[model samples]
Target: MDPAPARLAVAVKAQARALGFDACGITDASPPGSAPHFANWLAAGHHGEMAYLARNAARRVDPRKVLPGLRSVVCLAVSYPGDHDNPPPPPALRGVVARYARFTDYHDVLAARLRDLTAFLNGLGGAEARSLWYVDTGPVLERDLAQRAGLGFIGKHTNLLGRTLGNWCLLAEILTTVALAPDAPERNRCGTCARCLDACPTRAFVAPFVLDARRCISYLTIEHKGPIPLELRPALGTRIFGCDDCLAACPWNRFARAGRLMREHTRADLAAPDLIELLRLDAAAFKVRFAGTPMARAKRRGLLRNVGVALGNLGDPAALPALRQVAQDPDPLIGEHVRWAIERIEAP
Candidate 1:
């Protein structure tokens, strides 16, 4: 409540920008405004296999549950727009990774920066300050907090889009007892634009501002552990990792500049990977290839499972040899998908 904490907020934002964060703002660590919507989403089973969302539902509403007596939340964004040189891969035997995952894991990148911000705040607030930070790994309603902090409004497609950064930014949060002054919330800017919703390959957006992860290509390719549903396989197309159709379709992205820090981390090879090569990756090879990247999170089997669907959708006979090899593999998850790919290629 003190004016000193208000001044500290200004300094924190300046320092965060210096550390390469694209945007920064503060909000009181009260319950998230989206708690009701989140509860509804979970009750409707829209979250699918992401059981952790249900498990951590309570903690998301109240930051104090994760960090006792938390009074301020410092939210930050770092843009990861795809490299200007790296356009979407041609729809062929090539598989596309989400632009964000085309680089080093954002979790690691954003967490390190948030830690530095925490140390700065702790030093300013003295021993009375307690701080904890998260980079998408926490049970926080990040979009709600980010919107409340004035960074951006949550777009109808369910992503936070800033006037400048569009939907191409990653978010991080720091919860602290330092009591920084909060920023005013941003007004909703998505008046009539529904391009993001209309662009979904799998019709994941059940309605404006609501997403069904059950049918989302990103969720299917990355989060869902078992085989992808047959109904969604054709929509999976050549996207092996995550999908960016909705985010890329946002008209606001016309204002988005290429990511400065993330540009250096983008791997050209990952921009449009050869599906045949990905199918050959055994567990050991997968780890070695995508060691520090977000792609590693899917593991070899999950990624290969996705690759089979993509190859099937491509219906490219060039992939038949690889799919046949994978069909004989010991992992039923991948083998089953490989068999499906073979059927699709062989089908009239």
Candidate 2:
């Protein structure tokens, strides 16, 4: 066992922490152990409209497919203050953005830091070293790789959870050509626990570890751009962006730590946005408000569509006029959801 590679792994982790990552680990870039399960999950049509996941299926199972000569994966986690990240939705008709989305787009926030870390890794491994970093969009089974790297274990909710960061952390990875010592993997500790499965309002979990994204509030609101199915609209409550009930229910959060990197990027305004205000956001206004946030990726129509469902679930009569006004929105998606809101408020 050469000491040089082990020393390099330690330095890389220390550098990651200095860059504001809360947890970091190193793992060999072998094909993820869950590749077959993932293929079966995709085949089961549980991914909903996220076709990109299916298209990148092959690359996702193997880091070598993504980067030739990839020898190591640097797994990093950044915890956003889980304790207060999700304040109860305000008394007013305000909508809740998921804890992760309340910050400036995490991808943008983490990318800058990842670039610096990659550069540092390159320098540590000498001139011929090369690396590529991605927050969550990279074609790799990051959650499984994170566990193999000893950063965390995959819980029943299918989220990576660590004693220190819980399931409330965001993951990033850097695939590098440099060889490094692999850390011991963490084994699952969710024995006799099903809180996350029970916490889901829409029963998104088909079984202990299988999630059906079609019924997931986060996916229905954030990823699926078309009108949400009628059956799931009421379950959305006021969550206009993403859902965190499953993550919040995890017991491991007893050790949840506050993260430094995301604190700097938090958008206080997104904590509890006025539902009506959000519903009325035209394209220009939407862009101005959510320019650098995760909601920007959802776009104006998608967000307001969510806003309409939220207002409907809130069942407040006061929101009717606004819902009615937006029922004729130029974007049919917004109009459809807004019309649903109007009917819901009008229902006996």
Best lDDT among the predictions, by candidate number: 2
Model 1: per-residue Cα lDDT over 104-204, one tens digit each: 88887777778888999999989888998889888899999999999999999999989888888999999898888999989889999899999998999
- My TM-score estimates for the predictions, one after another, are 0.97, 0.98
In the range 1-348, model 2's lDDT, one tens digit per residue, is: 999889999999999989999999999978988988899899999999999999999999999999999999999999897746557766889988888888888999888999999999999999999899989879999999999999999999999999888888999999999988899999999999999999999999989889999999989888897889998888888899998899999989998888888888878898889998888787888899998888898889889989988888888999988888888988998898888888888999
Q: lDDT of each model, Cα atoms only? A: 0.88, 0.90
How many residue pairs clash in all the candidates, one count each? 0, 0
> By TM-score, how accurate is candidate 1?
0.97
Scored by TM-score, the top model is 2
Single out the weakest 10-residue window by summed lDDT for candidate 1.
Answer: 80-89
- Which residue pairs in candidate 2 have backbone atoms (N, alpha carbon, C) closer than 3 angstroms, thus clashing? none
